[model samples]
Target: MDLGIAGLRVVVTAGASGIGLEIARAFAKEGARVVVCDVDAPALDALDSGLAGHVCDVSDRAAVDRFMHAALADLGGLDVLVNNAGIAGPTGRVDQIAPEDWDRTLAVDITGHFNVTRLAVPALKASANPSIIGLSSAAGRFGFPLRSPYAASKWAVVGFIKSLAMELGEFGIRANAILPGAVDGPRIRSVFEHKARERNQSVEEVQAQVLATTSLKRLIPPQHLATVAVFLASPLGASISGQAISVDGDTQMLV
Candidate 1:
């Protein structure tokens, strides 16, 4: 089905790899002019999307401002903003986590979204159909053991989007968050390994236990999120806002 977002200008953070990259590609496929930013300069340069890429650290307000200028200049305006840049953060007990680690995690996972969305607001207001899609996680809904920093940050993202929906709705802009659970990728493998070590279980066992929480008992792919991103930015999602949609095969909880 045509999403009716062709020619729209979209910006995706950390779009050089993983879920972010897939979201950018999905927008490009939908005929939207896409711009992506990542701190990984080499990865940004190597991206095959043929769209504009910038080296940006979303946690840095100045860097985000610069990126917004460049991206807005390239696209003339913005229709969609995908705040997808995030870190897995330290996986350990809260008491074991360093103060710096907690601060850094919150900066990237939560503050980064604020930086980008603040800069993108003006351009978004000018669009006929503006949308802001944020990346949260299933951990945002349920607490995760040994993942306090990550969980806290992801939960903050949900709050941010909810507030943004109310603030931007007056301007005809929509805001929502996507909560993914145990996505299939290197990142999740790393997470599973950490959980295994922490729980004294095998990686396979830890992964199975995590999957068992979901009705599908499967790991979701980055593309699953990409599809949702596309749908949320399209006309079909015209009235959808302030919703925290989970793409985790119907996650029941986190164990």
Candidate 2:
């Protein structure tokens, strides 16, 4: 399926690695001109030549400003913005989590979306088929035990994306959120490790418990999310807005 996004201008946050990297690569595969920003300089340097990369921490407004300027210049304009940057946050009881950790999570997960979108909107407004895709999580829809900070920030992401859909609809810029559950990656492994340590259990036990909540009992691939994002940004998904689409194989809970 040609998503009909060839030559589309796009920017993806934290696109140097993990899910974000897959998104950038997917867009590039569909022939979209892609620019990605990440805080890790080494990762940025290692990105595929097809995808331009820059160093920027989305939590820092100044850094986002610089990245957006550079990225838009490279793309000549913007048609899509993929807000995929986020952190696992601290895994522990609400009382056990530190105030700083909570603040940081919100800053990057929610505020970071605001930071990038505000800058990308003007460019997006000029496009004929503009769209915004935010990477929310299953935790956003369900309460996650021992992951209060992550859950709170992800939930905020849904609200943010829904509000953006309403606010930007007049400009033909659609906005939606993708809620993935337990994506297969080092990040999820680390999250499992943290949860296991917190619950005095092994990583395998925690991983199994998490998968058990899903009907398919499996971890989601980053490419699956990339496919949904590309479709949403294409003309084929013009009517899809204000939606919290789940790519998680029928996940029932966050475990």
Candidate 3:
């Protein structure tokens, strides 16, 4: 399927590596004119020549402002905004987690979405087929233990998208969130490692316990999320909005 997104203007946050990188690559593969922003300067420098990149920390409003200006200039305009930046946050019980950690998690995970979306909205409104895709998580839909900050931030993403869908519907802008499960990556591995040490268990045991919650008993591929994001932003998904679509492997819960 063509997905019919050739020449589409797109901006992806934190697109220098991991899931964000995969989504950026996917859009580029589909022939979209893409620009990505990340805090990692080296990763930005390493991005494919076909895709433009800038350094920006989404949690900082001023930084996001600068990034959006540069990205919009590169793309000439925008049709899609992929808010894929987030952090794992500190893993611990609610009372045990530091206040700073909690604040920082919400700052990057949820506030960052607002920082970018607010700037991208004007450009998106001008497009013929504008769409906003937010990267939530399975934790957004479930009560995750020892991961309260991350869970709370993701849940906010769903609420944010849902409200955007309603508010932007008249402008023909579609807003939706993609909830991913334990994705296969170094980030997840680090998360597992942290959890294991926190619980005094082996990494393998923690990993197995997490996978056991999913009917498929597997971690999600970043490419799978990229594909769904592309489809959602394409003309094929014109009628889809205000939905939190899960790309998890039939995940029953977050362990």
Candidate 4:
């Protein structure tokens, strides 16, 4: 199905690895002119998808603005902006969480999105079908007990997208957030390990408990979320805005 995304100019933050990398590949596969940014210089250099890559730290406003100018010039204009940069944040009880850790999490997860979106809006407005896709988490919907910082940041993403959708709707710019649950990756494995240590359970036990919350009883592939992101950037998702779409396998809760 022609998703109608071909030739579109796209930029994805933190797109050198993990879910962001997969999303960048998806857009490139659909013939979009993709530009990706990451703090990992080696990963950016090694990206084999034939898309543009830049070293960018999304949490830094000046760095984000620099990336925006370069990316927009490379692609000539922008049709989509994928806000996928974030950290797992410190895993600990509220009292145990360090002040610096909380600040860092919010900096990357929430302010990072702001840094990118505000700069990309002007270019997005130039496109006939513009989109802003945020990578939120299931924790945004279901509060995570031991992951207060992560949950708070993700919930802020949802709120950000909603407000953006309303503000940009008249300009034909669609804004949406995707909520992923238990995606299979090193990142998630690390999260499970942290949860296990926090709960005083084995890693296997933590994994089992997490899977039990999903009706599918399996980890979601990063490609699944990538596919949805591409769809949202396509004409097929023309009217999908201000919505938090879950790509989880019917996850019941975060606990």
Q: What is the C-alpha lDDT of each candidate?
A: 0.93, 0.94, 0.95, 0.94
lDDT of 2 at 70: 96
Best by TM-score: 3
Most accurate candidate by lDDT? 3
Pairing residues by index, what is the TM-score of model 3?
0.98
Ranking by lDDT: 3, 4, 2, 1
Q: Could you give candidate 4's per-residue lDDT for residues 1-255 as a string of tens digits?
A: 888888989999999999999999999999998999999999999997587899999999999989999999999999999999999998778999999999999999999999999999998989999999999999989989878999999999999999999999999999999999999999999988888887899999999999999999999999999999999999999989999999899999998
- Candidate 4 local accuracy as lDDT? 0.94
Q: Write out the backbone clash pairs for model 3.
A: none
Q: How would you encode candidate 1's per-residue C-alpha lDDT over 1-255 as one tens digit per residue?
A: 888988989999999999999999999998999999999999888897567899999999999999999999999999999999999898778899999999999999999999999889999999998999999999999988888999999999999999999998999999999999889998989988888987899999999999888999999999989999999999899999999999999998888
Off by more than 4 A, model 2: none
Candidate 2: pairs in clash? none
Candidate 1: residue 48 lDDT (0-100): 79
Candidate 2 per-residue lDDT, tens place, 46-96, comes to 999999999999999999999999999999999999999999888778999
Off by over 4 Å in 4: none
Model 2 vs. true fold: TM: 0.98
Residue 29, candidate 3: how far off, in angstroms?
0.4
* Deviation of model 3 at 171, angstroms: 0.5
